[model samples]
Target: MSDFYIRLYKDSDYKVARQLFNSGNAKHTKKAFKHAMRQPHIWPPLLALLILPALDIVSFTTSIFAVVGAIVFLWFAAWRMYWSYVRLCFLDDMLDIRRYYLEQDGRCFWVAESGGQVVGTIAASPSSYPGGENHVELKRLSVSPSHRGKGIAKALCRTMIDFARHRGCKAVVLTTSLVQKDARKMYDKMGFRLTHNFYRPKPFTKLLDFKILFYQYDIPKLQ
Candidate 1:
């Protein structure tokens, strides 16, 4: 059998991991939103207008008070929307790296090294619920753009699954957003099913246009 190595993340891998995550997120987000600008009715802006009424501090009984309140609310809303969008973009860029380096989980953090360089990572930890020994949570899994489609992610995932099984974890669960189609496909190929669909709306980022779906995977223990 060919030899490949996977291990826990180290402090030295932080910078490279951040770069990989940002680059991949940028590519994925752009590809997902390629047709966004072409839509006639921008959803974020419309939603902002609808919520203006609720922001009114003055009595809505008077026309003048209502109009002033609406104006003030819109100004703040627009500013918030712009800021939220910027933060969302930044968060998307840094998510994988952040989870890898900053997570408080203690089970394990696995990194795939090729030629002494970090190509991908998978982090897993035990479930927080009481008497949950038969389950583990795959928190964050990402592969560098340059090394994708080479089975790096799959190898890392399999390694984690095997480790979990050996530790008596009967199944593994993970969550990914709907925006990440490639990731969703990977999970499906690995036998994950769509267990839930939830909405995570961010109005402040001018991003009320999309909803994210959550996924779960139940991996059977090896015989």
Candidate 2:
């Protein structure tokens, strides 16, 4: 982190960001989505696994072909669910970076580069919800696993807070999953207070324990 430089995101940074985003989801999609499977919006395969036993009522096992058909259908549903979770949910913003992250007013993205190579990233923009116009959202903070513990994450977090302040934001907010333990600790140390804790019932009582936490950094009033 010592040699790294922080700068505004450029058009060229898109490729690296996209790659990083995809690699991140490709690696953790299963575990993260698996944790939230009870959420109505993710992982259709496990749902099938639970529901398939009921298909005995439909006589799916009546013939070898029926069984094969059921098997193929389950496989296809699983594939679709994986695709939806990873591409549509995880990488949705990166799918249209310019439109989502770059084109908005009061929006900005930054990258941490070392040796001319991008290794860390963060973004901040004004919130869209009512009463949040004065608030900023710090998002997409990613540091290469290899670059951990060198103060890069701290620098990026500080960068976003400062950016928000400079942008005249009253506060900056961010959300993270319970899985991001290290990040949660860092945010606590950085003076971000927990503002919300909620669970999404994606599909009802089936999947549980999908905890998401929101943190807020309130800017002090001017003298």
Candidate 3:
């Protein structure tokens, strides 16, 4: 821990950051996928299988085709839901940190390095909150599993908060899944209040009941 320090992200850090994100996010994907299976997307197709029969909408041959279509719909929904989770969690804006966070004004991206090895990362970007341009949303907080409990994550988080304070931001916000109980706790311990708790991304997330919790740390309050 003495050797580790948090610093601005570099092009060279991109690969390791993406790798850490993928591996760290794999287990959560299962949780998200399971919740997705319970979404309305999957339910509609199943309901169609029952409704089409009750309505007697077709002849025997047509009914067979209808059943097949319903099955395909179910499969497609499952695949789509799972893929959405993957894209949302893995194919993130961190993939292009320069374009997404670095080049933009009031945005930042950083990585934690120890012995010249990037072991953790975090990023911040201006929030869209009305009249809150000074506010930032923290993103991509991750620590290498092999390096857990070494204080790298806490250090990275502190870096983001310090960066926000220097930037004159009002506060920093972040969102995490319910599956990330430890992360939520860490944020709480850091004085970030759970501002909102809900299933995010609207209709899709609503059906899955995929609970996402939002946290916010007031820079002035912390200081």
Candidate 4:
């Protein structure tokens, strides 16, 4: 922790920061695929394939192929779902971090540097919701896998929170998914409260019970 420092993001940090973003998001896709496989509903279809062989409806070899194919399809579906979201992110604010965050008033991006490498990143912008005029949205937070557990993420988060405070924002808000267990725990420890959650309005997400969680940390207004 002593070796790392948090500072405003720079153009030079873009490449490494994008790598961290992709790596972090890739982990979520893997976790989501695993979670999808664990759902009770997923087993019934595979079980049916096995039962076909027992009932002599299909050869054992064909049943095996069907089960394996189903599993592969599920994996592919999960990957597609997650990466599609990532692509949209790339098309949006991430497409031009400077224009979206750095160039805008009351919004900024920060990175954690250690050994002259960017190990973590976080950004905050005025909330985009209809009635969130005083709120701030925390975005693009990622820490290098190798540098995690050393307080880099928490420190980056603190930087964003303090920035929002000084900017007179009412609260800091962030959204994380069910697969991001570590992030959920960290947010809880940092005094952010879980407000609500919802599953993406898609068949695959609904089937797997994949959910997105929203957390908020309200700042006390200055007297």
Candidate 5:
């Protein structure tokens, strides 16, 4: 951790930051595939497809096509799910961090550097969630896969929390997925409390029980 330092995001950090963000999001594709497979709705169709062949109701060749089709569909669905999020991020704040964060008061983006290379990123902006106008939202908190367990994330989070405090924010809020267990644990350890547990409203996401967790850390009032 001593080898790393955190600083305000700069124009030169764009390439490495985008790479880190894309890779971080891409790593979840496997998890999404597994999650989709575990759904009971998914297994019912697969089981029915297998049953047809076992009962000789369908030719073995047909069964092979059915099972392979199911697998391929699931893989493609997972790929779309992962890339959809990446595209959304690019269309949103990541598309121009300086415009969304740097140019606004009570907003900022930071990167963690080690030996002149970007290893992590995080950003904070005023919240838009209901009843949270005075709160800050933490976003894009990702650490390089090779750089985990070294306190970079915590350092980045601490920086955001302090930034919120200085801006006189009432609290800090953020959203994450259940698949991000390490991040969930880190938020808990940092005194952030769960505020909402909900799934995305998309049909497949709801059917698969994919959940999004919201958390908030209340800032103590200054004397």
Candidate 6:
């Protein structure tokens, strides 16, 4: 069997990473939009109400107020929701692609062909803790769809764990949405246990309708 190699991400890998991200995004964006529109307070009835005023079928003043109210509500709601979705998408792209080339925190890795074709990637950064005890956070991990079912994610995760250990981290932590069942299963199999579940409503994570699961695993002492 040909061995797959993993290494640090390089500036040259950005193009392939972007291509992979766009392809994956195209597969899910429409469904995500539909899901967002179905939220109880999102798609309020506006056009049907607008006709009430034009036909003078009701008190004009009351109809005007109702129409204006609905328009304002929809505008504000859609503004909040769409921007949130955009931020979340940008956050993923930043962590997955841009940060690698920019070396934002100087911590990221890539898996690729020896001849230099990028196939998978994993990125991490030091945690925001003091006392020389760092918590490594896996920011992103992705494999080409064609490369799935070959243990790439597992190998990438193991590499990250080893890297964190080498850097003297006391523990490693990561968060994934409950919707990502396969990823949750993989993390569980890797000995990471769920530590918390909480809502993340930041503009950069709008599409994550459910609470996020935080997982943690203590680094074993080296013999």
Instruction: List, residue by residue over 1-223, the lDDT tens digit for candidate 5.
Output: 2889999999998888888889887887778778878877888888788889779899888987999998887777666766888889899989988888899888999999998889999999889989998999999898998889999999999999999998888999999877778899999999999988987765556645568899999999999
Candidate whose lDDT is highest: 4
Clashing residue pairs in candidate 5 are: none
What's the lDDT for all of these models? 0.62, 0.70, 0.75, 0.89, 0.88, 0.66
Q: TM-score for every candidate vs. truth?
A: 0.62, 0.70, 0.72, 0.95, 0.94, 0.64
**Candidate 1 weakest ten by summed lDDT:** 203-212
Runs in model 6 deviating more than 4 A are 22-106, 114-116, 129-133, 202-209
- What 10-residue stretch in candidate 6 is worst by lDDT? 24-33
Model 2, 1-223: lDDT tens digits are 1889888888888888766655644544344544554455444544454455577643434444555564455444434443554566345666666777778877778888988899988888777645686999888788887777888888987888887887778998888766567888999998899977876444322243446788888988668
Clashing residue pairs in candidate 3 (N, C-alpha, C atoms within 3 angstroms): none
Clashes of each: 3, 5, 0, 0, 0, 1
CA RMSD of all predictions: 8.7, 5.9, 5.1, 1.4, 1.5, 6.4
Q: What is the lDDT of residue 176 in candidate 2?
A: 79
Tens digit per residue, CA lDDT, model 3, 1-223: 2778888888998889878776666656566655556666766765565576568875656666876786555444434554565567555675577787888888888998888899998888888755456788888788888788887888888888888898778898887887677898788898999877875554445545568787888887553
Query: What ranking emerges by lDDT with the best candidate at the front?
Result: 4, 5, 3, 2, 6, 1
Off by over 4 Å in 3: 33-92, 202-204, 221-223
- Summed over model 5, clashes come to 0
> Which of candidates 3 and 5 is the stronger one according to lDDT?
5
